[model samples]
Target: MPAITHEAEPAKLRLAVIGSGNMARRFLKQLPDSRRCVLRAIGDRDPGQARVLADEVGHLCEGDLICGTEDEVLTSDEVDAVYIATVHTTHAQLAMRAIAAGKHVLCEKPLTVNHVEAMAVVDAAQHAGVRLVEAIMFRFHPQMAAVRELVRSGAVGEVRHIDAGFAFYVPSDPKAATIVTPDLIIPDAGGLEGRLFDPHLAGGGILDVGCYPVSMVRAVAGAAAGVDFLEPVSLTADGSLSGDGVDEWAIAQLTFGNGVTASVRTGVRMVDNNTVQIVGSRGTIELLDPWALSPSPRVVVRRVGHEPEERAFPAPGAYALQMDAFAESVDGPEPEQVSNADSLGNAATLDRWRAAIGVRYPFERDDAVIPTVSALPLRVPAAAPGGDRAGTGRIEGLDKPLSRIVMGCDHQPDLLTASALFDHYVSLGGNVFETAHFYLDGQAERQLGRWIAARGIRDDVVVIGKGGHAPDCTPEAVSRQLVESLERQGTDHLDIYLLHRDNEDIPAGEFVDVLNQHADAGLVRVFGGSNWSVRRVAEADAWARANGKRGFSMLSNYFGLAEPDDLPWPGCLDVCDAESMRWLTERQLPLFAWSARSRNFFERADPADLSDEVLVRCFYGPENFERKRRAEKLARDHGVSPSAIAMAYVLHQPFPTFALYGPKRLDESRAAFRAVEIDLSPEQVAWLRGDQS
Candidate 1:
């Protein structure tokens, strides 16, 4: 879609300011000079404050200005765009609501409290097709544009290093008191008792001011290299924390992939030089005040032998320019000053900085609360196909029907990311989640547990827990890890449990006995093995039958369209061979197939690229490549992606099969879900697998 363009005469962009704080006041003051936009409303939690601010700026509006609570302004049809000048923690939530209402948003920096929240908001905006930009006003300043031009013009000659700092001291007051809650922080006293000193509000110098220097470094370095932005390859940081656990001061050294390095320093408890200096092979450029650009905006350039040259850029205030850019974006593309990727990357860097200093907000560690875009809990979509159920298969000992495509939770790093994907999966009628005790050292289990708790859908969803991985593959380790995994998952029992890997040195009967005990105790409903051989599985089941214990009912080995020539991991097994397939068909045991799409083998177009070492080492062969080619041909015939064909091949097996799919993004999960809608005949599946091609 074309960007929104508001000319002087025909149409004016209508905007609403959604906070009554100092930042909101500053933005309101810029309306008299803004040409492309008109003030439509003023909103705040306090209606009196909103009315006061609205009256103060009423003359700038060409129409009747609405004044009410933030929620009212967000839902008002009079507002075309919203300026979110609220506290740091509320940025993501407010932006989400604005996007939900189909309003353009210019949110304050740092975009959200953390990278996870930032990603959620960005994804929401993109999905909604609405404009969303972080309110980093300085980027739209004319002085910064001149700096970028100077760097891009080669005046600096191969930029190699940068040093930037933004810091100031705010005196602590003894009389100030703050009430900290899970979602917000209320201050009894003004200024000193405000959000700046509260951990619940994500208060810190790094997020508040450090973002300026980090963003400047990225912008300047990218201009020198002719790109929009460059991410750092490595970052090392050190900082001090206050009594309330916010960063007092910090310094980080970032190394970029383009051989450029930078040092960024920020603080709220101390004062620093508050300048930016860029060093290149032949010269250096300096900014007296890069962020505020007060007094006079100037840049100083000094070469090896020439005298220092100073240039000045005078224009409208930074806030005015930022507002103009936001208006332009309503019908246009996002401003390059603070694009979606830039905002997400900046948030990620800030997250790393905080992680380095051992600074984590209380909400971040709370497992029972998942930060979501909407206020209501996520539930399965009511209008889904098949009336709230998709294709599913049942195992003998398990009561709940497991979705054909099981969600693998190891790839999600945080609760927000996990919940976003998990919510989408459930919306598509998927109910089973695959988790393991050793994934991320149990972090994945905790995150999944948090998602389940927050959504209050433990009964609606099925959990699969795997334990006793190699090196700890013992009956005793299985029992011990099961207890810990249950606690981490916040569940009394896992619906389906599996041994991650086999320990063939021990008797198969010993492992079966431990599993049966857990099943009897209700800690596990049904038990299986992940990478055990077919012979060992039969041996364990034989022993279970003899002892009148519950036998193994399922297997979770690698099964897909393209057979693997070698194992990716030490003890991982591929059960696509004829012997294993025949055994599974005869025994009628359900198989949970991991790497069902051959770990993205069918998605790779170039068979000769050989860039991915693991893919090359495990799945590279003439037969596998032939299978991939045939899958692509079948996909074209069916008008679907080659990956869809690969997935269909696994689901079309004679035995009950559930494909364990690990997707890192929402779109990937949606695409995986589409595989269930495809149908393939047994002849077509065999042909794609090279059985009769």
Candidate 2:
């Protein structure tokens, strides 16, 4: 699809402002009229703020301003593009909304708090053919280009090191100049107290001020490397936290791929020279006030043999230059000055620094609360052949039915790949798509969300979101992950959810209670355990019975026809032992068997020819080899693939079992469908196992 241009085709571009905060106000003040950008709408969650900006915009443009909800502004026909100066956490979400509405977007930086969300927003923008630029104001500053040019011209003599820092001291008192006092500035509701120090809003020194230094270093390193940007090879950081746990001061040491090293520092509670210094073997260039928010800057160059030279740069408001650049891109085919790579690279670098410094926002931590659910269209089941047949088994306590065969989405590369697989599975009677929060760094859910939303089949399929894998199996971890999973999946509730892995340190009862709490709120319909021992399942069930809460209704364990000689990975549980199998058989609880074909052990002629070392270690035992041989022989007798026989063995078990399969191609998907066609009898299953009884 081509980029969605404004319908009016007027010389002036239609613009809507989505925030009325301090930054937004500064942007409006610095914006030049020659840019031919018409401010058509102003929207904020607080209508009063929106009206204030609207009145100001109306006075300037001499047109009635559209002061309404965000939806009104985004959907307004007069608006061609949106400038988002909202809080950090809302950046990605609002950008996505603007893109989906077929409007261009200039989002306030750091694009998003995390790289994952940033990537998703960028992908969405590209898919929609709309220009989405991060609000890295410094990128558009004329002096920045001058610095880049000088460095590229060898004035810096093969830059090797860069040192940059931005700091300011803002008093803690609410009456401070930086804080609030309607008499001093605009009426500030929360002041800095409401935003700058709040971790939930992703407020921190690194995100607010540290980004400029990181961007500066990346830019200079890119010039030295003759690339747009240089990826960091390693990063180390340390920071001081505010009383509220947000980073007040932070510094990071970064080593780039070009062997260049850089040190960047930022803070909100200290005073330092706000400058960028680039040091090379022969000379050095320093730019004072690199952020250039408030004053003109002095550029000084010192060389090994010559007297130091200082140049004066005409002070230019970075925000004005940024808006002009955005307007040009909106009006023409030219790309934004700050490319997606720059934004994504900067965001990823900041994410690393935050991680190294142990500065995590509420959203990244384990205690983040679930966002309020907005009403969305329920997913409707697709009326397709075998679509209903796929969901054959009925699990107890789940309102929605699930397909007997589960589809794994751990390796889906893109939306097209996922769409193809989703279409194929649904066409052949599959509905349950299994994903974990950690899978693809939460991309699986995002991809599934896009697919389902585009197809309008949310109700037609069952979504099973798994979270709380090992190392984060506490009750709080589970709750927090569940909330993020639901948000990522773009659903209010899940049909069936499970823990991706277990932690034995935490009591099983604790897990049950947290899961049940979500169930009570309709966030989860039916919950279960994955890779959990049978003993742990019993413990949870016993507690659930006593507390009147739902227990693990299903078990997802590593079960298939082949036996494991060793564990596939550290801390992985294989519940195919005789005792575990007996326990499931006697209880008749539904079993979601992962790696149902022993990672395709029987699918290969040479079991030892496997490439997956984990599979080889887990299924290379003599008994398993003998069983694969018997399965192959049975496949020859039954005129089916050995892999199909293995699948059939799991499906034909005495217990209620569903095999989870990951098919990368259509042919493999078809084969999977055919595997279920060959139902094996109890006698046949035993015979394939070489148990003549």
TM-score of each: 0.86, 0.59
Highest lDDT among the candidates is held by which one?
1
| TM-score of candidate 2 on Cα atoms, chains taken together | 0.59
Q: Return the lDDT, model 1, position 215.
A: 90
92-147 per-residue lDDT for model 2 (tens digits): 77887888799999888778877656765776677578888888888787788888
State the lDDT of candidate 1 residue by residue for 198-309, as single tens digits: 8988888998889999899988878888988888888999999989898988999999988999999988776787789999999999997787666478889998889999
Model 1 ranges with Cα > 4 A deviation: 1-10, 174-193, 294-296, 305-307, 366-375, 383-387, 391-393, 411-429, 472-477, 505-517, 538-550, 561-565, 578-589, 596-616, 619-655, 662-693
How much does each candidate deviate from the true structure in C-alpha RMSD?
Answer: 5.6, 12.8
What TM-score does prediction 1 earn?
Answer: 0.86
